[model samples]
Structures are given as structure tokens and as C-alpha cells.
Target: MRAIRITEDHAIDVIEARVPALKQGEILVRPRACGICGTDLHILHHGFPGTCYPVTPGHEFSGHVVAVGQGTKGVREGDFVAVDPNVVCGECRWCRAGRPNLCLHLSPIGVGRAGAAAEYVAVPARNAFAVNEKIGAGVAALIEPLACAIHAVETAGRLRDRRVLVLGGGTMGMLIALASRKMGAGEITLADPVATKRAIATRIGIDKAVDPSALGDELFDVVFEAAGAVPALKQALTCVDKTGTLVQVGVHDVDVTVPINPFNVYEQEITIVGSNSLADKFAAATELMPDLQKEAETLIGEPFNIWDFAAAVESMAAGHAIKTQLVFD
Candidate 1:
């Protein structure tokens, strides 16, 4: 088997490796399509929390079940599935409370275990949700990110009839805006510096897409910062209406800090919240994908072969596509 490996010294290689042995309740999947995410970039260049060195870096993926381990239920050989990468310790307090994203021992597949940037990857059968084959592998691979977007919107509470603003026009931002619209947001505004991104957002049913500088004197009931950039976060903070909520959906450096007005937060009754990973929304995202198939399809760009992992990373870093993926031959 061929697997893309990222070492601790920031080296990437597509090396011949042994197929992963499935444990009890695990299934071995032959990944057909995998999406490279920002987290993969972090794991490659610097490092991301919980990343295991020499790891295979692909979390957003869908594949066929080639083999099922003993005791595995609900999944079978030849079943097409999209996987939930977050592997939690079900005995943890957060897990027991149904907030597995915050589990004390959360070890996501790509970050902490071997992931799907290979010919075959092993995952707990419970993490694999059967998806319609008609959706195609590219869109099925999007289910993971869509689940995260759903969790982000879920963190925002009520959105029906609320004015919503999403910062950024990347895959996560686009999905967040789409999710907001699905949740009955009265109006959706997406701000991105790139004209191409704004165009894509507009084409995908965003109510309004404009340059960040063009947004003047307008505030939103629910503001989402999904760009994972400090500048976008700063902009999102100011776009929230009084008594409204601001959802932080972006990943930031551990040491990074941005200035905020304590007075405004207190006097205006602003609620600030942080949304982590998908939580328990993977199944819901799988259920929602068929309805969102066309829209999701528009976000995907031409895919690179799984062996061209470096090129895919470079393309993603260059902002060449809204969603960059790898396809198995």
C-alpha cells in the first residue's frame, strides 16, 4: 500500500507501507476520495494539537469498506461510507455528557491516529456512516466538514429570521453560510477579500457577498468568524449587533490574541462563544448531504491524485480552490 507520511521534522513522503490491521470493532476502508483541510497543512508545516508524527494526514474523506473487523456492526464489506474522524474515549465526562468533541481523551483519526491519505485506513465501524453512492465520492468526502459547519451553527442557537454574517469565503465559511441559510436566517452576508471567493459565494446562494472593506455600518444578529485568520476574527467582532451572538468557528494559534472591548461586551450584552469540531453532528450531516449535494458539488475543485499530496497542499495554500481534494485511481 502507498501512504503519504508526514514526519516530525516537516518532511512529506509517499512511501510503500503495510495495510493497517483492524482492531475489534474497526473496519478497513479503501479511501476513494479525501479532502485536504487546513488542519492537514498545520500537521505538515508546523504542528497541530494531538497530531502524531509520521501520520497520514486526511480526515475529510469517504471510502468503500473492503473489510470489516470482528465485532463490528452496522458496517459491512462493500458499503460506501463517510467517516467521523474524532475518536473519543466514551468513558470521559464530556463524552458521557454528549459533548464528545470536548472529551478529555479525544484522538481524531488524522491527528492522533493513521488517517485516510493512503490506499487503506482502519477506523472504528461506529465512525463510518453509510452514505448514498449517488452523491459521489467528492461530495461524500465533504460530510466531515459539513458536520463541523453544522456544529458551528448549532452553537449559535436560534438563527431563524436573524441577520447572519460569515467572515471568509473558504470551504468552511461557505458551508457555514449555507448552514445558516438552511437554518432560516433572514439574510446572509459573507465578507471576503478575494473577488473570486465572493463570486463563488454568490453563486452558491449566499444572499450577499462583498469585500470586507465594503461592509459599512451594518451589523448582524449572528456573526461567524470562519476564516481562521486574525484579521477576519477582528472584523467579525465588530459586525455583531447589540445583544447578538458571535460564534468563533475558526482555529487560531494558541498564543494569538486579539483586542476586544470589554465595555461593549458588557454594555451591549454581546455573547461570544467558541465552536469546536463536529461534536455529534456527523450523522446529521450525512443525512443532510443528499439534499445539499448540488451545492456541495459546486464547492469542490478539480482533484489531485492521492500520490500528489504535496501539490494538493500547495494548491490549497495558494487559495486556488474552495475545496481541494485527492482522488484514488
Candidate 2:
């Protein structure tokens, strides 16, 4: 099989590797499409921790089941499925408490195990969810990120009849806005510095799209900061209503200071929530596939076949595209 292996820290090589044999409770999938994310970019620039590189780096992907492991039921061979990359330990305190995102062993499939950046991948059968025939392979690739968006909006609580202000216009940010609207937010505004991104947001149902510098005076009941960068997150606190909820969906590797003047948090009575990845919400997202697929088919940008993996990385780093995908032919 043709595979792109991360041979060492900050190094990648495309090689002809022997196909892996699946063990019990796993399934082998022929990779159709996979998307590049900010996390992948982080791994690409800064090598892995403990000097260990990912075996294969693509996590956000979708494929058809070519074979199934023994003891796996319901998911059979030839089922079209989307992969849930999270690999959680069931005995963790957080898992017992029903929040697996905070699990002690939350290493993901692409991070801890080999991933879909190759001609084929083997994943735990339980992590695979069936995708309907109506959903194209490109759109199915979006399920991974949309699941995160779904979980973020779920943490934000009811979107119907509420005012929302979303910060950032990247793939995550855009999907956050789409998910909020799908969940029935009455009024929503998307703010970003990119004119092109803002335009894209408005076309996809955000009530208004504005630059952060030119934000309006309207108060919001919920402010979603999908931009983890300092300025955007810092500005998020100021944009919501006095007693509003603020959900920080974005993540930054470095320390981010939130200077809370005692009076502001106390007097304002604001609620702050930090969101991570999906948990049981993977099932919920699977249920929401109809709407998610509708939005993804239209909102997802172009797909790229990996003729040259290095060029794909270079183009992604250059910001020449939105939602860059690498397909295994």
C-alpha cells in the first residue's frame, strides 16, 4: 500500500508500506477523502512530543468499509462510514461522569494510532458511523469537524430565539455558525478580519458578517470565540451581554491569559465554558447527518488529490485555500 509516513520529528516520507492486518473489534477502510486541520498544521510545524511522530497524519476523513473485524456487528463490510478519531479510555473519571472529552487517556486515532493519509486505514469498528448514499465522499469527510461544531453548540445550549456572535471565519468558525443556525439560532453575526471569509459566512446564513475592528453595538446572549488567538479571545469577553454565556471553542497550544478584573466576572455574572472534542455527541452528530450534509455539501471548499503531499502542506500554510483536503487515489 502507498502511505505517507511521518518517519521522525518534523519529517514525512511517502513509502510503499505493507498493508496492516486488522485485529478483533476493528475494520479496514479504503480511504476516499480526508481534510487537513489546524491540529495537523501544528504537528507538521512542531514535531511530536517525546520525539515520537504520528504514524499517519490524516484524522478528519471518511471512507467505505472494505473489511470488518471479528465480533463487530451492525457495521458490516461495504458500509459507507465516517470515522470518529477520538480514542478514549472508558474507566476515566470524566468518562464515568459522562464527559469523555476530559478523559485521562484521550489520545486520538490519528495521534496515537495510524491514520487515513494512506490508501487504507484500520480503525475500531465502534468509531465508525454509517453515512447515507446521498452524502458525497467530500461532504462525508466533513463529519469529523462538524461533530466538533455540534458538540460546541450543544455546550452553548439552546440556540433558538437567542442572539449569537461568532468570532473567527476559519473552517471551524464557519462550521460553528452553520451549526448554530441549523440548531435554530434566530439572530447570528459572524465576525472576522477576512473580507472573503466574511462574505462566505453571510452567504451561508449568518445574519451579518463584520470585521472585528468594525463590530456593531448590538449585544449578544452568547459569544462563541472560535479564534484562539489572544486578541480575538480577549475581545470576546467585551462583546457579550452582561450575564451572557461565552463558549471558547478554539484551542491554543501556548498559555492564554484572560485578565478578569474581579468586578467584571462578579458584577456581570458571566458564564464561561471551555469546549474540547466530541464524546457521545458522535452519535448525535451521526443523527444530525442530514442537515450537516446539506450544509457541508455547499459550504465545503475544494478537494485536492495528493499528487504531491509537500505541495499540499505548503499551499495550506500559505492560506491559499479553505478546508484543504487530500484524497487517496
Candidate 3:
């Protein structure tokens, strides 16, 4: 089988590797669709919890079950399923407490475990969710990233009738906007420096996608930092209303001090939260996949093949692509 591997030299090389023997509770999936993600970008650039060298690196994916494990009975031989990449350690305190996203030893399928970039990959049966035939296979692949956004919005909580502000117009910010609207936000605004991204947001029913400088003075009941920039984070703080919630969905570009003033905290008493990877939000996304697919397609600008991974990564790194996905099928 063929798989794309990121070696210690920070190079992406595709090669043939024997598939791992399926475990007792796992199944072999011929990955039909896999998307490039920000997490993959981070690993490609800065080497993360990523293995030392020569590792397969795709996580957001969906596919057909080619073979089932010994203990798996419900999933049929040819079921189309969406795989939850966050393989959590169920025994950890966080997992025991139902917050497995914070699992200390989380070796997500793409990073610590093998990924779905190959012709065939093994995934735990428990991690695969059945999808309706009504949902296209290509769209099934988007469930993972959409699930991350679902979790972020759910964590923000209660979008009903509030003034919502989104700090980025990238994929995550668009998801946040849709979720916020679905949950009944009274007024929603998206701010991004990229004119192209802002244009996409506007095309997708976001009336207020604009530069922060041009957005004028306005406080928000909730603010989300989706650009993953320190400046955006600072601006998000400034835009939140007194005692409103702020969710940080963007991966930071660089570390910086989070300014805190007792006066602001006491006077406004705001609640700031970090929205990390979805806590099994895939379940919700599975339910929303049909609608989300139509929406994600409009937001996602293009598809790139494995051979073009480097160029796609370069475009995304340079902030050229809004949502980029890989075509492995």
C-alpha cells in the first residue's frame, strides 16, 4: 500500500509500506476522502507530538470499511463511515471525567498512530460513525473539521439572540458563524484582514465580513479568535462586551503574553475559554453532515492531490487558501 510520510528532515515523501495487522477491535478502511487541516500544517512546519521520523500524516478523513475486526459486528463489510481521529485514552482522569480531548496521552490516529492517507488504513471500530448514503463520500471527509467547529460553538454556549463576532474568516471562523446562526445569534460579524476570505464569508450570507479597522466601534456578546494571530487575540478581547464569553479557536502563530488587568476582570467579569479539538463532536457533525457539506463546499475553494500537498501547504501558510482538502480517492 502507498502512504505519504513526513520524515525527520521535514519532507513529505510518499512510499510503499505494509499495512499493519488489524487489531482485535479495529477495522481496515480504504480511505475514500481525507482533508488537509491546520493541525497537519503545524506538524508539517514545526513538528508536533508528531513521531520522530517517517510517519503517515492525515487525520480528518472518511471512508468505506473494507474489513471488520473480530469484536466488531454492527459495521458491515461495505459501510461508509466517518472516523473520529481523536483516539483518547479512556482510562485517563480526563477521559474518566468525560473530557477526553484533554487526555494527556492522546496519540491521535494521524500523529501517534497511523493515518488515513494510505490506500488502506486501520482504525478502531469505536471511532467510526455510520453515515447515510444521502451524504456524498467526499463530504463525509469534512465531518472531522466541522466537528471541531461544532465543539467550539457548543463550548461557547447559548448563542441565542446575542451579538456575535468572529475574528477570522477561515474555515473555522466560517463554521463558527454557521453554528452561531443555527443557534440563533441576533447579529453576526466576521473580521479578517484577507479580502479574499472576507469575500467568501459575504458570499455565504455573512453580511458583515470586513476589516476590523473598517468594522467600526462595536461590542460583542461573544467573540471568537479564529485567525490564530496574537493581534487577532488582542482584538477579540477588546471587542467582547462586559461579562461576555470569548472563545479562542485559532492555533496561535506565536506565543505572547495574555494581558490581564484586575480592573477589567472585576469590572467586566468576562469569561474567556479555549476551544480545542472537538470532544467527540463528530457525533453531532455526523447529524449535520448533509447540510454542512453543501455549506463547506461553498467555503472550500479548491482540492489538491497528494503530489500537490507541498504547494497546498504553501498556499495555506501564505494565507492564500481558505479551506483546502486532499483528494486521496
Candidate 4:
């Protein structure tokens, strides 16, 4: 089997490795497509929290089940499915509270354990969600991130008839905008520095997709900060209407900070919330796929084979691709 691993030295290399044997209640999946996320880049350059070294890094993936270990049920051989990478500790306080996304001991595939950036991956059978033929593996792979976006919107309280501004035009930003629109947001605006991303947002039916420099003084009922940069966060705070909600959906560096006036928050009663990874929204994301499929398809770039992992990373970093993915050729 061929696999891409990030060494302890943070160097990515391809290696010939023995196929992993399935454990009890696991499924052996031949990954059909795996999207490269920003976290993967963070892991490659230096480190990402909870990522053990020499890990195979791919979380957003869909594949065909080739075999199921004993006791596995609901999934079968040859079933096309998307894998939810987060494996939560069932006994954790957060899990017991029905907020497993914040499980104290969460192990995510591609981060804390071996992932699907290989010819085959052994995922717990329960993590696999079977998809119908109408959804290709490429688009189905987006279910994970879309689930995150759904969770973020849920954190935002309500979007119905609200003015929403997504402060980024990247893939996640676009997905957030799409989700907001579907939730009955009165108007959706996307702000991005990149023209290509803004254009893509416009193509996806956003009411407005504008350059950050050109974003006027219009206030929004809800602001979604998806860029994960301090500047974007600062701007998102300013874009929110009085007593509006600001949802931070992007992952940021631990050292990053933004300055804001304490009195402003007190005076406006602006609600600031943060959304982590997906919770129980994975199934909702899957159910919403028919509405999101067209735009989701547009967001993925040309697929590369697993061996071309470096190229995929380069494309994403260069901003030449939206959702660069690895696929079994």
C-alpha cells in the first residue's frame, strides 16, 4: 500500500507500507477522495495540536468499503460512505453533556491517528455514513466541513430573516454563507480580498460578494468570521449590528489576538460566540447535500493522486485551488 506520512521532522514523504488490518468493528475503506484542509497545512509547516508526528493527514474523505471487521453493522462491503474523523471519548464530561465535539479526549483521524490519505484506511465502522449514488465521493467528502459550518450556524442562534456577513471568501466562508442562506437569512454578503473567491461566492447565489476594502458601513445582524486571521476577526466585530451575534468559525493560532473595546461589547450587548468542530450535525449536512451539491462541486479543484500530496498542499497554499483533494487513481 502507498501512504503519505508527515515525519517527526515535519517533512512529508511517500512510503510503501503494509496494509493495516481492521480492528474489531472497523471498516477498511479505499478512499475515493480526501480534501486538504488548512489544518493539514498547519501540520506540515510545523505542528497542529493533537497531531501525533508521522501521521497520515487526511480527515475530510469519502470512500468505498472494501471490508468490515467482525461485529461491524449498518455498513457493508462496497458501500460508498463519508467518514466522520472525530472519535470522541464516550465517557468524557462534554460527551455526557451531548457536546462531544468538545470531548476532552477527542482523537480525530488524520490528526491524532492514521487517516485516509492512503490507498486504504481503517476507520471505526460507526464513523462511516453511507451515501447514495447521486452523491459522488468528491462532493460527499465535503459533508464533514459542511457539518462544521452547520454547527457554526447553530451556534449563531438563528439566521432566519437576519442580515449575514461572512468575513472571508474561502471554501469554509462560502460554505457558511451557503448554509446561512439555506437557513432563511434575509440577505447574505461575503467579503474577501481575493477576487476569485469573491467571484465564486457570487456564483453561488450570495446577495453580495465584495472586496474587504470595498465593504461599506452596512451593519449585519450576524457576522461570521471564517478567515481565522486577526484582521478579519477585528473587521467582523465592526460589521456586526448593535446587539447582533458574531460567530467565529475559523481556527486561529494560539498566540493570535484581536483588540476590542470592552465598553462597546457592554453597550451594544453584542453576542460573541465560537464554534468548534462538528457535533451531531454530520447527518444534517448529509441531508442538506442535495441543496448544496452544485456549489460544493464548484469549490473542489482538480483532484490529485495521493502521491502528489505536496502538489495539492502547494495549490491550496498558493490560493490557486479551493478544496484541493487527493483521490485514489
lDDT of 4 at 44: 87
Better of 3 and 4 by TM-score: 4
The model with the greatest lDDT is 1
Candidate 1 whole-model C-alpha lDDT, 0 to 1: 0.93
Q: Quote the lDDT for 172 in model 1.
A: 92
How close is every model to the real structure, measured as TM-score?
0.99, 0.93, 0.94, 0.98
| Candidate 2 weakest ten by summed lDDT | 46-55
lDDT of 3 by residue, 129-224 (tens): 999856765578778878888888888888889899999888889888987887788789999888888888888787588887775668998898
| Model 1 lDDT-worst window of ten | 247-256
Clashing residue pairs for model 1 = none
| Candidate with more favorable, higher lDDT: 3 or 4 | 4
Candidate 2: how large is its RMSD? 2.0
- Clashes, model 2: 0
Q: Which stretches of candidate 1 lie over 4 Å from their true place?
A: none
Q: Quickly count the clashes in candidate 1.
A: 0
Q: What is the C-alpha RMSD of each candidate to the true structure, in Å?
A: 0.7, 2.0, 1.8, 1.0
Our model 1 lands, by Cα RMSD against the true structure, at 0.7
lDDT of 3 at 46: 72
Best by TM-score: 1
Give each model's whole-structure lDDT. 0.93, 0.79, 0.81, 0.89
Model 2 residue 23 CA deviation (Å) reads: 1.8
Model 3 TM-score, all chains together: 0.94
